[model samples]
Target: MTSFLTISLDFELHWGRFDKTRLRDYLEYYQETLQVVPAILEMFEHYGVHATWATVGSLMADNEEEWRAYMPTVLPQYKYERYSAYRWFDAQPQIWEEALFAPHLVRQLIDCPGQELGSHTFAHFYTCENGGSAKAFRADLKAAKTIAKSKFGQELKSLVFPRNQINEAALAISKEEGFDTVRTNPQDWYWKHTVDENLIKRLFRTGDTLVSLGQKTSYQAPQRNGEELLGLPASRLLRPFRKGSLFNQKRISRIKEEMEAAAKSGEVYHLWWHPHNFGHYPKENLRCLEDILQNFSVLKDTYGMESRSMGEF
Candidate 1:
């Protein structure tokens, strides 16, 4: 059986759209989002699935007082920043919203096993682009880790670069920070020129040959340096995602079939995504998850692949 591994999830909520006005209005839709998070946790608990949440540290700070009421004051610090990947709305609006919502999410993370809280950068900058300057970029990560330690008590280790943007500079800082792994996109040089649907298409890292002339360099797990951070790339999809639902039953069946074949071939198949994706069609996605879980059950029995979070990669 192939020793298979699933990259779990990089769970955060309501990304993709980030306009101030729209963000303010969109906040109304997620009013009940904080409430439904427990159900998502239950799904994983029931399935015996392990996942990693590249936690937004703000999720903890926002709800700090509320959580402290219940948890020890000396909890692990989590990394969440005011202007990080959470760049939406004006600073006040963003801070207010986070203050209202993050505590519950942070508390939810406290006891989850088979999970790792990794750095997703303090500011969700496209370091590869943005001309943000290397010094500025490195400074931002430093601030994020500070927040993570002060707020969550956890040392920032593994990372998932914002949008999987990677380059020599990013590699250097990540290694400096002692991050062991970082997810990277090794598609092509001009692939991300425009942020259209193709933006994701431009993120594929094929055949493990990441450090090609055009592709981002090979990122190893337990990131070492420019070319050493652990690289956990998502496997190929049979087809592009036309719908936003958690993959359907047919896809789950297909994924299971692929895992079976790979186990026979002795290779690692990695699957990953953002958890808030389920929020798009929560009920239907849960159904899809059940299908996927069933297939994983089959895979577990047939192949010896263990579901692993990015920390394990």
Candidate 2:
């Protein structure tokens, strides 16, 4: 098989972070994200990069009533109440439509060339949290598929677990709901477990961005899990561009070297990040992206590296 590059974006504006952040505090950041997504899509088109936007299903709703109409009948009952988006929604008197909902942007992602619209669960469901159940996860997947078909006439075939919390039971439910491909965390020690802030894991994950600390980040191909979903292991995260950071060039160079290795070996290099990562420094981020894509263009010319969406793989 030929070498390939896949990019997936966890495209959940405030919904992804509401549990940890106050919307009012980062209003400007998300506002910039509104502008950044479109520009990012334009660059993807220019670079001929195929990407998947694993979107939060609730963002497809144009209003609160519609959002309510499509919500899963059974919501996740997390022991830690803050992990439940429904509880947060009910507690808030007013919703910031621009920051919380984004049907327009989702539509743009659908119309963009070489883009796949995938699911990030109905409510950014955290499956690994205590009290989460298989029944609730099934309901969440159903709501995700229902809203996508009803609103966009599209079917979701790819999934990315919220916070990279992959559950075996949830994978079975996702396959039954029609998602055939799922993004998995890299097969590295730091990423093998659930999302957490272990000091050592954080330190190593950050260090790996600037230097190799684990196995070769690129892999051969998607593997079939016992649950029957095609597991696409992530290679690296395109870290947000940091202005005047001394290590910025080193980080980009590390990514480029990995891409080259994948290209020469005819392997796959999967890169992912959130659109809001660029919300604060879009210009610098886009420049970093363009630099990376320019490298991909070189590899494409030299080694026939092809760009692919998750579903396409």
Candidate 3:
């Protein structure tokens, strides 16, 4: 059998830093790199590559004026999360100026080919670990689903929880909302690939490297002690580089080596990262992605590996 590859991206917007003080600094970064989205589509189109985009619904919910200014051709309701909005938004509906940017960002992603707008959840609710407001999260998903149906004409299914935070309760809630799969950390929870505790804490992780690639496992249904109510473990790891830049030949080599090995193994390699990172380092990141896809093309020919979407995985 062929080793499968799943390259997924969480497309969300970022207006400022998690810290309010650094808001302007981050907005400038967003302005400089917004063009990366189109560039990303160009590269993928060149490589015959497809990816899953865990989307943000709030982008469509953005105020309307900004949409006409920044992304004229793109539809706003179809995309969200790629642009972070702490600075773009204001307490009393502050900076209503930036709100228009949201819809355009959504439009670009929704119309992009081979990019599935998977849910990143409204406001990236970190439910499992830091339960700031689970109830609010529930409301966000409902709103997100509504926008998806009305704006994109698509039904939402898979979810990439904010912070990769999940548990049985989260999954139960997700399933109730018609979500079949919720991403989780693969460890003592479910489909643990290896036995080494430390090594497993780095490679096979989401948001952050919780562990390393310890072992590989098959796709199984949820069990009593499963990791998530519905589990989808991200199985591949990049070189842990920042999203914006091409680090060096060494880093690229290391990532390709790991991908090459997975291609030979017949196991599923699910890869993910944030879209705004592409905006941050558009040129360098595109080069890095180009190299990654080159390796993927090689494996596709040599091992007959196929690409899959998050729903299929």
Q: Which candidate leads in TM-score? A: 2
Highest lDDT, which number? 2
What does candidate 1's lDDT look like per residue over 205-304, in tens digits? 3212222334222222233345566766655322323365454445666556656655656555656666555544556656666666666677677766
Q: Which of 2 and 3 is ahead in TM-score?
A: 2
**Candidate 3 local Cα displacement, residue 205, angstroms:** 8.0
Per-residue lDDT for 233-307 in model 3, tens only? 775444334644444565666556666777776666677677666555567777878888888899999988777
Question: What clash count goes with each model?
Answer: 24, 0, 30
| Superior candidate under TM-score, 1 versus 3 | 3
How do the candidates rank by TM-score, highest first? 2, 3, 1
How do all models score by TM-score? Answer: 0.72, 0.97, 0.73
Per-residue lDDT over 1-313 for candidate 2, one digit per residue giving the tens place of the 0 to 100 score: 6999999999999889989999888889999999999999999999999999999999899988999999999988889999988999899877788898889999998999999999999899998889788999999999999999999999999999999998788887888888899999887899877656598998999999988888888888766666588989999999987777899888889999999999999999999999999987888988999999999999999999999999997
- Stretches of candidate 1 off by over 4 Å are 14-16, 19-21, 63-101, 186-227, 236-249
User: Which 10 consecutive residues of model 1 have the lowest summed lDDT?
Assistant: 69-78
